[model samples]
Target chain A: MKHWLRIEAVCASLAIRSRMAYRLDFSLSFIGMFLAHLALPIYIVLLYGVSAGFGEWSIGDMLLLTGTIQLARGATSMIMSGLIWHTNERVQQGTFDLLLLAPVNALGHLLNRSIDFEDSGLFLSGMLVFIIAVVISGITWWQALLLALLASFAIMFFASLYILFAAITVRYISTLRLFEFQDIAAQYAQFPLHIYPSLLATLFITLIPLAVVGYIPVGVVTGHLPMIMLGSLIFPVLFLGFSVWYWHNTLTHYTSAGG
Target chain B: MDIITITDLSKTFKVPKRKEGLKSAIQSVFRRQYETKHAVKNVTFRVRSGEIVGLLGPNGAGKSTIIKALTGILSPTSGEIRVLGFEPFSQRKDYVRHIGALFGQKSQLWWDIPPADSFTLSQHLYEIPKQEFERRKNDLVEKLGIQDIIHKPARNLSLGERMKCEFVMALLHRPKLVFLDEPTIGLDVFAKQAIREFITYTNKEYGTTYILTTHDMDDIEHLAHRVIVISGGEKVFDDSFAALRKIAGVTKHVRVVTQKKVVLPKKGVRGVMHISPYEAQFVLDREILGIRDLVKAIAQKTEIIDLTITDPPVETIIAQLYQAKA
Candidate 1:
């Protein structure tokens, strides 16, 4: 594990240096991500003023939900979002083979190869909102510990989704349409889970597991976690394991683009 | 010792088959036809340590596929390949530590950063000790004469300079075996010579085995002790480089412009093109009609205006081998 972290450090340092080469574009990417993630949390705050309860949730509860969604996606984006774009690009350019030549798993190598330092802006924005929401909704220290554990699971869940998308990208060689799928998942995740019908909510809670990313963690923070839905916590770990298996299986479908 | 071995290796790909005319194309959108292309057939060969072997073939003749398999990027459809006693595709992570590959068209350097940064990544990637990494890196930099170029962004460097940095990155870990796919492609003569010399030096000093695929016959002649020719996805010829020359059958293409009618060297000369009675092109068998004998025969018969003798082109030799295979 120490050796692997050293390798990851090397890849991350090089990636940051490469991004910094074009200073203006680097700054613009940071600003773009910062503004893009700021809207939903700000919108939630504003909506709570005109309406006391927006769809059966208090202002503090909604803030925690939006904040949890932002933080989960924001952190995952900083580390693994590059997997989508670069995997598509490398597969198209035939450089994906270079990943296999390394003395590490190809997926792990790609994750490090495409670290997105610019997405740190989004992560910081999410951090700001999450702290504010946590302050608004007070909780005991044990609850805080549980929140931390669940939040780690949330980030893991989002990262696994990126890997799944990357696995699909190896076969398709294009990620343009994949953004739509991710957007829909995120859009569903930011709202309270009860807003959707019970069947669709159950699907989100387990199968697709978008609820694992935001609703469950934020629900704990807001003291609204569904006792019956405690079983959903196991889905993130299962999803991560499946994503890794699926990635290696998908590699066989990689008829590399060039000779 | 046999450092590498492959037996009955094959790779097949399923591609969408196309038909002529717009109607067929439209129909194909709904229900497409597919065809299986055998990129590699039951090809087999072995390479011993410290030997340079050249894989010669025309474009799309599966040379790159074989390299990909040997590098552990692609699994063969059928067969077994063991390099240093590990299966390339199954034990790739460990097997890859013992090998390195440089595909000339694909770069290992980051385009936006100095190659020096990428080298640090390489050091950690292969888990080379820092002190050992620095020593190996400095030595390669000095030898390749890229001391200054390593600090420049790869995009700013010239092709040869960038390639030099690439070479340094590839050999930093001192892999036991290396695969080079057209390493000298699109290089100038000086750059080509430098790369060839570098390969020779590395092979000698480290006892590194090399499997090279290139179109430049000069590279084969200069470096490869053994040559393997692939055509139609099969190994058509494998032998010493001198033997491949024999496959050209000791023939040289000679075009002559004369002051008089051409006098045939009846024993070893075959007429090829008769443009005019005074001037003609012919194939001269160097073994049967020695250069000295042909010159003497010609001088005694006619006053020569101009004479040129060149070896048969590489295409003819490949065609001859393909025909022999058929």
Candidate 2:
């Protein structure tokens, strides 16, 4: 584990140095991403201005949810989503064989292969919004701990999804459509579960666990979530483990078919 | 002393077959047909330690498929492969740590980063100790003489310079075995010589076993101790370099300048190119016709002006080997 961490550190250093070569472009991209995430909360505010959003949910509450989702997406987008994009490129270019030749796990190497600092801009923008919303709606330190724990599980849950998508890239070998599939799933985090139908809401909360990303975590802090939903957050960790196993299994099966 | 062994190894690819024209293309969207391409048949070979084996074959002769299988990049469709005492495909993560591979057409260096940064990544991946990594890296850089270019991004370097950096990266870990797939393709004479010298230095000093795949026979003549020729997805020839030449070298090229119209029997000689009736060129199978007997036979037919005989080039031998029935 220590060895892998060192490998990750070296890969991250290389990625930063490569980006630093084009400093202006890197800074501009960060600004662009932050602004894109910032647009979501502004749209929510505009919608809340005309009418009431979900039942008893204030504009500050929705902003808090959006900010929390951005932070989770930002952290994963930097490492995992970039991995899927690069995996598609590597498989097409045939450089993926190098990953197999390495002594480390192929998925682990891919996670470290692409680290876009520009994506962290979303986290910065999310932090600003979260701090403001926290000021608007005060919460206890214990509630903050619960939010942090849920955020970690949310991060892993999304990372597992990205890993599965990357594994699909290996099997299919070319898929620009995967981005659409991932984006469609992720957009669910933008809204509260109460707004979605019960069946779809139950699906995301129970099996997909996307609720921990924003809805449940924010609901807990706002005192809108029941104790039963909070207990379901533990399942995301299990799903993450299963995804890891599925990734290795997919690689083994594709070895016989892929170039 | 065996470092690699492959038994009846084969690979079959299921390739989507499509017919030409818009109608077939549209129909294929709903239903597609795939054909099995037998890239490598049941072939078997072995490599002893510290030997340079050249894999020689024509295009589509399954050389890359065999290399991929041996490197653990592709799993065998049937049979087994053991490299350095482990099954290559099943035990890939553990087995690959003891081996290294270089694909000339594919690069390992990061295109936008300096070779130094890429080397650092390799060092970390292989878990090389800092002091030992420095020593080996410095030695390879000195050997390749790339001190000035190592700091530049791989995109800025010439093809030769980038190839040298790749060599350094592959060797810093000192793997027990190395696979060189077309390592000298598109390289100039000087670069090829430098790479050959690197292979020799490492093989002699570190006892590294190398399996090279190349169309250039000069690489085989200059470096390989043994040659394995594949054609039609089967091993056609496997023996020492001299043995191959001797087996494929039985025929001699002969040219005869005659004073009169001499009819050389068509049954005794093949490829008889008659330049007018006074001169002709033909190949004589030394196994069947002797030079002394030919000289006497030709002298009796006419007053010969001059006669010359020489061995055919090595490529002709390999070309014939390529067309030989499996």
TM-score winner? 1
The whole-model C-alpha lDDT of candidate 1 against the native structure comes to 0.85
Expressed as tens digits, the lDDT of each residue in A1-259 for candidate 2 is: 8988898888888889888888999999999988987888888878987987777778878877877777777788887768777988888877888778898877888888877788888878877777666666576657656675677777887787888788888887777577676567668878988888899899888887778778888897788987677787777788888888888887765543232
lDDT of 2 by residue, B1-326 (tens): 88888999988878889999999999988999999989999999999999999998877788888988898888899978999999988888899899999988789998888999899988888889899999999999999889999999999988889999999988889999999989998898899999999899899999999999988767887899999988767888999878776667567789999889966864558888988889999999766777787888888889989888866654577677656633
Checking candidate 2 for backbone clashes, the offending pairs are none
Weakest ten-residue segment in model 2 chain B by summed lDDT: B317-326
Estimated TM-score for each candidate: 0.89, 0.87
DockQ of 1: 0.66
The regions of model 1 sitting more than 4 angstroms off are A140-145, B20-30, B249-314, B323-326
lDDT of 1 by residue, A31-128 (tens): 98888888887887787877765665777677777777777778888878888989988889998988889998788788888888898888888777
Complex DockQ, candidate 2: 0.44
